[model samples]
Target: MSFEIRIARQFGERTIAAEFASKGGLTALFGPSGAGKTSVLNMVAGLLRPDTGLIAVRGTVLFDASARIDVPARQRRAGYVFQDGRLFPHMRVRDNLVYGWKLAAPVDRWMDLDEAIHFLGIGHLLDRWPRTLSGGEAQRVAIGRALLSAPRFLLMDEPLASLDRARREDIMEVIERLRDELKLPILYVSHDRDEVERLATTIVPIG
Candidate 1:
């Protein structure tokens, strides 16, 4: 098991919660829009802390409210890919990919800069800026940036939501490769039933 999550947070009158243990591979949070799927992903990524409960990944306890444990976001080593590829507007593709890589310590780093570029097939786009890349290309670069960080697990929130049908399929194949070839643990959040069915090994409903 790569994930053990049972957390909840209050937002005024609404309370967002999630409870599930991943059975390896890619686990998805499936639900309708506005059901707090992204919030749960944020909690896992340490961008948002749950008011109460535990969040453990790969046997490492990230947050345990009962124990008064809340690991810092950088220490969590969670790779997060947002719906839109949030690349640095000022940086070229190469710089963007290496930003996280440089932040990770040598021992913590698993993938090298060249390996990530080759894996993502973005070697040719190194000189290009973020605005110059296409949607699918930008997404691939985003994944590469996250992967180069050498995270223990990945949290993807609607990674394919902004793409067209053809581009979605392209990115889906890339994700499948990450799951099958790299064997990286992923917590994916999506509202599309078909996308969840195609990408997730275990489907945990949200809302």
Candidate 2:
């Protein structure tokens, strides 16, 4: 099992929390708009500090409030693919992809540049600007960037939310390949029932 999460954060009078121990493979956080599903992902990725509880991936501890342990975000090595595919606008595709790869040591980088481009099918977009790429293309580039980062785990926050059905299907196929072949533990956030049913091996409800 890769994910073992039991976390809660306070937002004034409101408290957001999620508790689940995955059996491995892809895990989805299923819930509504204000459910704080993304918050849980943030906590796991070391982006947001939880007021209490533990967040562990595989056997490594990323956060444990009781133990006074909190791994920095960069050290967590989480490949986060946001809904908008937030690629750097000023940089070309090639530069954006190498950003994280360069930060990682040669040994820590699990995949080389050519390999990630080939896997994500973004070979052609290497020179294109983010503005020129379609929605699907941008998302593909985002995934490629994540892969090149050599992440131990993945956090996808509504990856298909902004795409049309056709484009969504395209990204879905790519995600399926990642889920099956990469074998990395993925924490996916989505409000769509169909998306969750199709991609997640384990479902954790949040609200």
Candidate 3:
């Protein structure tokens, strides 16, 4: 899916206006901390309302101030992955991965549970708790959960920020594989230049 965002919002006294568009593949939102990167993603995900702008994915109107259209967050067909991996501590890996699939309402369910387990190479870790898994493993499960939702667009915000060098590398490799293998459109938020170089086919430099 393609994306186009033209938004303006007030951040205290400063007026922040973000404008960009990407066709497909992985697009990196590159900028310093607190540069409205996450805000853009949130707007696209229908989590935040823009002051006056247009946000669309594959010609689908997500937010249009002119038309007074604002889709709810849950209604947007976008999968969001946070830095924290936000797995349910009380749930097992299997349960955590299937949570999105079991949510209210329904659409196309692309990623199968067993297929995802094999895709992320986490079959052996399904029975383990989040605490027992390493940082990379936890992130993989998080991504898997997002994929199982069958999102048309993926919004990932610094997903590998918490991992160590080795763990980050491991997860990055998996991300690369997902990009090429799945051929899914992604709006990846990150500050790491190397990660951008390795994964992004397009770049949106937020400032």
lDDT of each: 0.93, 0.93, 0.87
Residue 123, model 1: Cα distance from true site in angstroms = 0.8
Model 3, runs deviating above 4 Å: 104-107
Cα lDDT tens digits, model 1, 126-165, are: 9999999999999999999999988999989899999999
Pairs in steric clash, model 1:
none
TM-score of each: 0.98, 0.98, 0.94
Cα RMSD of all models vs. native, in order, equals 0.8, 0.8, 1.5
User: On residues 1-207, what C-alpha lDDT tens digit does candidate 3 reach at each position?
Assistant: 388888888878876678888887898999988888988888889888889999888789889999999999987878888889889999999988988877734658877888999888889988889888888889999998898877887999999999999999888888888788888888999998998988999988988
Give the higher-lDDT candidate: 2 or 3: 2
